[model samples]
Target: MKMNPITLIIVLVFLYPILKGFLFKFSSRDLKCDIDDLSRNISFIIAIISGTYFGKKIFIQHDDGIYRNIYNHIPQQILDYLENNNLIIYAIVIPIIVFIIYRVIKLILDLLNYVTTYPALDSIEKFLSSKGNIFKRTTGMIFQIPKGLCYVLLVAFALNIMSVLNVSSKLNGYLEGSKPYKSICKSIIMPVTNSNIAKKLPNILNNSFRIVIREADSGRQIEPNSDTPATLNQTNGRKTVVYYNGVTLDQGVKSDPQIDKLAVALGSEGTNTTEKAQMLYNWIGTNISYDHDKANKVLNNDFNVRSGAISAFETRKGICFDYSCLYVAMARTNNIKVRLVTGEGFNGISWVSHAWNQVYIPESGKWINVDTTFYKGGNYFDNPRFSIDHKDAQIAGQW
Candidate 1:
């Protein structure tokens, strides 16, 4: 089962009290053993967890491109500030800062108590006393707040590291294909009669897709109930314009200097367009994989294509758009003409809306179709009749 972050938060909340009780038993001298103190500990931990959860969720929300949902509600400047700052750090540090403020207040109260004979100090003490120990209880809870916050920080840090390592990807690999075949295998018109495509047909038919055609681009299949394509194109052409326009559509594909440099290093050895394209195709196909979780999210209308290559290269998992975008990014960075194509393509089983690419070979004066997402030893690269599988294909930016 997927590890629900919400469930983890709840587990942590419940687990804290037991751990605290165990520690209290063993370290009675170091810790207090009052029921009220235990209650305060539990409350503080719960608060920290709640704060962390919502904070992380908001951070993810912005990353996932769903901030538009709250864009109107929040001022743009505040949203911009949140986007610029790391919410996760703030989430962990804010409570500790509050604890520090409490400590400062308590120190001032202590100084006032010591000088109670002074008229000003006496007046302040009387004012505080009239408030009926509210300040006392509030400041008293400060000591435990930092402890609870420290625990929260440790858990958050560990979780962040685990996410970076993509523990979820390992877990997903085990669960893939566990479910029975669910999609009916439809006979697709094989545009190219390649034996390799034939060999993979059975696997596609038996493999049940959770989101099916909705997840990937189809060359020309009518999308009846799906979100609009992430990219658009204004003009269509058959020559270098088509390829150049595709390059134009790619704005931030290789925005990262690191990835830009990696692209250069990978393709620098290639003496020609074909060799460079092959190197990039091999790198992507060998490195990346079809993200099932992301596909499921796309099926549920929860995926975005704004980050493109940077996200795909960093995460090493994405759907067709991601794969195509990275290839386009790398290829263009090396000064090779490439176009990001969107349409329906067969995935060994069914024809789905997909994204692939066409790289212009200067020597041959032709645009060779390349499906880096389905890269298998150049099987899907430069096939003379690639249009057979990649139908309804067009360049990505129109709108």
Candidate 2:
């Protein structure tokens, strides 16, 4: 059989302390001190486990309150900075805070133990030591097993959390190959952290940090496109405007005087909706540069669609979402029906979260895909193999 190095390492690490406890002879005084040290170690272990478990639950329960407090007090720029770097902050600050809390708690417990339990424990330790070398060794080993297991459990729990957050792919891969890690995770960690509240924690944290406050909409109604019929031949002759609850598809589309004027000028060159849509697509792809900085900020969860579209229009730089948002606003200004679609797009290396547009052309009586973000690469406008790379495509909003 092939020897699994990771499993061997885990076994050795787990057994080392237990074996040491069993084999190493100690005087009564030393054994008593060791017992005190074991108690302290156990207290520290319990503090960490309980702190992590309960801290998560408390955060989940009161996330909204916490968010509101922070949102109200912090400046917007500082909030943005914090939200952008929340993962790093949590990774570093949370552990340090937990450790500090654990140390304080351990100090209190130690002081209490010294005052109340030291005499009794000393008597017990002396009695065990007096039972002869073999008995003393066996007792120490038996006591050491639970402490060793606690150490393993704590390490495994930390690894499980890092794995859940996908902190490092290389580290996670190594851990996955370790049989002991996998076994403990499956048997112990999963059971404790797989509850509904625990499962919702990531999303809760994300939402709490990235707070978006949308104002109530004005009562202005969306005017139906006069060029096309109320229903199109596509979508089985469904109405041109899609609605959810009382909200229309174009509700999120933002516009300004500059955008409106530019759209009119762009669309004026084409005779029909298809021609106009293509012209607009070509212009956006050729003119607008992809903003890599904004893309990185967005990946860190510091992005706003309204702001993105506005910035893209004014600056001619944006990522996929910005491209799609700009397209929707411009198309709507020209009375060209368009929808912002968001999903994964293959960027050669991997599938990434991407946004594009689908324009309804009355001439073809069909809605076609358009990805202006890929203009630098090639024609993505209604590409037949579009589905080959773009997947899980869902309409975000229409205009």
For each candidate, give its TM-score against the true structure: 0.41, 0.44
lDDT of 2 by residue, 212-292 (tens): 212224333344232422223223233234331122334435678998898899999999998899888998988898766
> Who wins the TM-score comparison?
2
lDDT accuracy of residue 175 in candidate 2: 65
lDDT of 1 by residue, 121-238 (tens): 3354455455544453443344345455444444443343333233464432322222211111112111121224434333321122111222222333223223433342221221
C-alpha root-mean-square deviation, each candidate: 21.2, 19.1
**Clashing residue pairs found in predicted model 2:** none
Give the range of the ten consecutive residues with the poorest summed lDDT in model 1.
180-189
Error of 1 at 336 (Å): 0.9
